[model samples]
Target: MTTIKDVAKKAGVSVATVSRFLNDSGYVSLEAAKAVTSAVEELKYESNPVARSLNTKKSNLVGLILPDITNPFFPELARAVEDVGLTYGYTVVLCNSDEDPEKEKNYIETLKKKYIAGFIVTSNQLDAPHYANAKVPIVALDRTINEKIPIVSSNNAGAIMGTNALLERGCRNILFLRGPEKLNPANDRYEGFLEAIRNSDAHYQVVTCPFHFADSQKIVENVLKDHPQIDGIFASSDVSAAGALKAAGIVGKHVPDELQIVGFDGVAMGEMLSPGLTTVAQDVYKMGAIAARVLIKRIENKEIEQNFYEVPVKLVIRGTTREGME
Candidate 1:
């Protein structure tokens, strides 16, 4: 295999100059750059990534840590991150923590040992101190880790919008299908829901469930069975909204007439549901893309204008809600 020294000899440049040019670490004269490029092309030279990482203390790999892969929303987010990473000449390594703090910690330590360049994290272990001291650039996606860490997320007020939609449709008794209590996004959404109904006369109940479909379905089924007065449901996620919809059907509740539902995250599966799902549509792809870009920029020592990036969200009306209520 051709080596950097051979490239330097072929281009009439010192090995140090060639290294500087290849890594873009230091300035090289235009003539030297041109010669190095020509030599590299002629020799078909491919630098060893492992050696380069050892020398630079960083790799061409970005780590994306997600809380749960079973949620459909995360897959879409992962795709966006992967696409952006590839475009920027970086490979994305996906790590699913399954909402386990120990697993997430292990992934972080292992990736850091391998000199991973940066991280895009959507896991629930943001409160861990190691993340604050990870010494690696981290961009929180769809979750708030802390003020010190940069975050890219949609407006949490989307939940308020969803809640108001249910209230406006004459839903006096509403049930909120919330996610885990400790998760930041889940708390932000639950807070948004409370803010929306603060002065309203709606009687609402909050129930916690995992983002999984089966668990949400089972919980929602029980809630619907015990409280026949629940005329509307505002789920923290589209998967939960789907569960509520299924539960309503199993309990013989006619949707949009007897019960109305609103879900967050405008995932594609929402549209496949029988009446379709009305949702607070967040641009999951854009959030992921922005997180990746922010991480890459930090890795490249570029200036970022802001630490907190808030993407906008909108309420999408669909078959789940009553017509003429928008």
Candidate 2:
């Protein structure tokens, strides 16, 4: 559909002028108003003020740049964002940054050139040097490099929620697994797990994984060989958690009986497992919804000068946790 933006560009007048003319406001000059009217007529413009605002500065569109859209976590979050966006009469543009800094930089530059209203960035690493010159408002999801940009993240207080969930369930010597350490989320969760163990007067071992299935499996296999006393395990992510589950099965260990396991992200795979995986649900869907609302409010609302959107975390007790334990 030919929008008011087309009319403004064709008439060579500012979008505000076209909007004023369309509204029959008295301020627009007679000549400019006539040109806008003629252009609107010729182009069959729909006179949508929202589309006209595209030319002015607000396009009623919010772009979401996620690190891994393929991940179950991201897809659910994306759906939540799109759901909330449509309700507010705004459009969403989805982009995958692939966790590459250069790819992320390119996406920001591309969206800016396309005149997107704002962005909700979900990168793996927290490095956004490109934002120092960003023209539009930006909200970070999971990654926050610059203090100037608003961050909407899960409450990364600690893995105590996940770790303690496993420990209290008779998991004496547990294996705590991890992924890449570039971002603060992983580090924070790891630290929380350690604190939980210390506080509980329990003994556990930490195993570092490379944020992938195969690598984590290798780490688990090595840990199993070195330590046969491990009674429980806490994997950093659902992907790696799945790998841990499979690896334990390889050694003929029954979940929550011979051993207990817990995962993160509350991913779709968690429930499908034999013993549904207990996980620390970060409320990914809510995170995306909150991020969209905050960035849009900060940009559209003239009243609010500053804001912070913080998402809370919760431990989802599923079939994965010990049947009778904590």
Candidate 3:
């Protein structure tokens, strides 16, 4: 409830100086900054963000726009991004686009009008020039937007190594259950699957799903019924992998003997599932951290490089793809 005027009186400085110091702009000399800090402690003056936003045209917030918040992968990434943003003294505003380009456009405009400090855009939609004039720094996550915008994502091409690991274990006839090409992650992973299949003598093909759990389940159930010869699967997500496993059971097929599965995104469900799905774990934590750091750097004018960052990926071979498999 203490006012800036009160702090100024105690510190023997003008209220404008206190306001500028609190907003992290309008540099103050070392001695004056020290006095302002001391006075802030003595009076406990809390600056109201609402008033500051009106004056400085900023909300002191970083917008985190994701394609699907319901997906375990994105929420995990969001948590990491929030943590990183907190470290840099910014609050994160979460928005779910649900893979809708229109909704994403609206959210971008809304956040732009709100004057968020920056943006961490993680979308499944293609980049649009509508946001080219968007103020503040924007760092894309998990996919590229435009050549002008920077993207930080996992080494999607490296999934071939994981798929090859499964093939090396004597599993041929691998099935790739992926989402639509509209999603860049799915496209990159599908290309990686192709690379692995082409390099090995193993046979593989892809099946497209709607990228939702219910649709993936229903579609995979039909696929399993038709192709009873499938021995292994590389799913674009943990959800699809789970769907595949559930369908295999309903069809009375035991996993790894009749069917082996490897999922993407080491979501909690991956480890908790029966047979514990083998998956390639995207370094989501590092992705989030790097996105946050880079966005902040650009905001502070310290970011020298404008390029794509490909984070590392690791194959988590679990109970699903065990030793002694066919």
Candidate 4:
């Protein structure tokens, strides 16, 4: 295989100059850059990434650590991150921690040894000290770690709009299928729901559930069975909404007629569900893209305008909710 030394010889430049030009590190004269480019093209030279990483103490690899891959929301976010990383000539390495802090720590440690360029994390370990001291660029996605870390997320307070839509439809008794209490987004959403119902005449109850369909389905089924008067539901996630829909079907409550439902996270699975899910639609793709971009910029030592990026969200009316009744 052709080597940097050979390229230097062909370009009439020292190996150090060629290395500087290739890495875009130290400044190189225009003439030297032109000669190196020509020589690289002519020789079809491909630098060894492993060696380059070792030499520079960094790799062109970005790590995306997600809490749960089974959730459709995360897969969509992963795709966005991967696409943006490719455009910036970086490869994305996906890690599924299953919301396990230990597993997440292991991944972070392993990647750090490899000199990963940066990370985009969606973790539930908000108080984990690993992130604060990782000594690497990291952008939190869909979750908040700490104020010091940069974050890219949706407007979690958008849940208020969804709750209001239910009230507008004359839902007197609403059930909120809340997510894990430890998650910042879940707390924000619950707070939004509470704010929307604070002065409303509607009766409401909150139940915590994991962001899992089966678990949510079981809890919702029991709640709906015991509280037959519950006519509306605001689920913390599309997965939970699907579970609520399933539970409603089992409990013989016809959606949008006897019951109305609104889900968060405008995941594609929501659109595929029968009757579809009325939901608070967050631009998840944009969140992932922005998080990746921010992490990449930080890794490259570029200035970022802000530390927090909150993408806007809107409530999407669908078959799950009564329309034209508000």
Candidate 5:
């Protein structure tokens, strides 16, 4: 393999000049930089990241920890994180904690030892002591973490608008399909749902389940049997909403007539369902981008105006909820 020495020799410049040009550190004359660039291209010299990291005291690596890789929501979020990290010239390392607190802590500890520049976490646990005590900058994605670290999330309060839309469509009683109550986002969504129907004549019920499509489907199926009067549903996630849709079919309930449903996350798969899912659409991609941007700034010792950022959300009307119902 061609080394920096070969490039320096070919460019007729000192090794120090070549190093400066390669790392973009300190300063090298424009002429010297051009010569080094040309020589590097000709020699196809690849910089040794290990050596460079040793000198700079940091690596161009960032860690992204998510609760479950099986969830569709996380995959989309992870894709956005990777794309944004690449644009900033950083490589992202993904870790799936599987909702295990011990696994999450272990991954954080391992990544820190590898000199990862920063972290973006969507933790399943309520407490994040590992992240709190981390040496590098850390940012929360989707879920809020400790107060010291920054958080990027969707507008939880805006979920009320989606619930209200269901009520406007003549749904008398609504069911809120949510995740664990301990999760910050789930709790916020539950609060928003209650606030939307507080003064309305319609009644509401809550059903907590794991964030798996199959598990949610089973819970929803049983709920429909137990409470046949439920006329509408507001699922905290698109996956759960999809499951609700399936349960409705299994129970022989006519969608948009006997029952209406709306979901969150605005995932593209929502449109592919037989009756497209109406939802409170949060920009998951934008959330990931903002998290990466904020974490990068912190890693570079740049000042950010705010530690908490909420990406906007909007209600999307679709076939699942009655159209033109006011």
Candidate 6:
């Protein structure tokens, strides 16, 4: 039960030092090596051959393929996954697809050749047939790719809650900034937003974006040019919401007054915005941890019944929207 991290802590040495002592993979000072050996003996630490064998037959690495590293959300998710993988003595290889399908496919092929233990993919494309025949386990993060692969994501209820928040703030006219239709989470958010406003008196419109700030900014600017009556906006992601904010500012519309906005993805940078973006925050860390745990279990050939896991979300109220705007 005692891990190398535990040995490292007790020995007052780094985990890398302990790992080197354990595997003789690299050079270590005699004092550090002695400390690690003493600590391992004291703790009765046992190496997990079974766990090592899971990835060792090919490689002791887990591949984490993401759409964009520039997106803060994905990086945070990747960090959590890497942390989990390291705790289990596996190296995490990060591959950014940059939202390119061909690039994603190429990375998949490359990592496959490397014999990665498993994959935690945040796919940009809707259909990824390359992973269909992946010999190792695969888990989708934040979106559904292959139907056979399990997916771990945040709850789509944030959209409904966000829409209601805007409506509660006296926003009668709202705009929903949706993301790519191929993403399951994006579609869920769009559907949830529509469902919330269906029976309400709030007038709403939908604008799809590529989930990029520039594109979303342009879309909002054009939408505002034509429909100045738009008082509220609910964006599918924080970056898009930032674009909406920029457009509102360009038109001299004050947040929480003339125009209120709510964005999905409770990214850390949201708090840095001028008014601190109001958002529906997903537990990115939790999503990553759950995905890593599930994928590792699958890699170990453990029996798992549930294939879909949805982490809960919260409505993070900030200065962007009013509880009941006057």
Residue 142, model 6, lDDT: 71
Q: Residue 52, candidate 6: how far off, in angstroms?
A: 7.7
TM-score of 1: 0.93
Q: Write the per-residue lDDT of candidate 4 for residues 198-298, one digit (tens) a residue.
A: 96988999999988899999999999889999999999999899999999999999998999999999988888888899999999889989998898899
lDDT per residue for candidate 1 within 159-205, as digits (tens), equals 99999999989999999988888777888999999999886988999
lDDT of 6 by residue, 98-137 (tens): 7787887888788777677899988856666777776679
- lDDT for 37 in candidate 4 is 99
Report the number of the highest-lDDT candidate. Answer: 4
Model 2, runs deviating above 4 Å:
1-18, 21-45, 48-54, 303-306
**Candidate structures ordered by lDDT, highest first:** 4, 1, 5, 6, 3, 2
Evaluate residue 219 in candidate 4 and report its C-alpha lDDT on the 0 to 100 scale. 97
Which candidate would rank higher by lDDT, 2 or 6? Answer: 6
Error of 2 at 116 (Å): 1.0
- TM-scores for all candidates? 0.93, 0.83, 0.89, 0.95, 0.87, 0.81
- Each model's Cα RMSD: 1.9, 5.0, 2.5, 1.6, 3.0, 8.3
Instruction: Write the number of the candidate with greater TM-score, choosing between 3 and 4.
Output: 4
Model 1 pairs whose backbones collide: none
Clashing pairs in 6: none
lDDT string, candidate 5, 52-108, tens digits: 887666788999988776777777788888998899889999898877889988988
TM-score of 6: 0.81
Candidate 5 pairs with clashing backbones: none
How far is 258's C-alpha from truth in model 2 (Å)?
1.6
RMSD (CA, Å), candidate 6 to true, equals 8.3
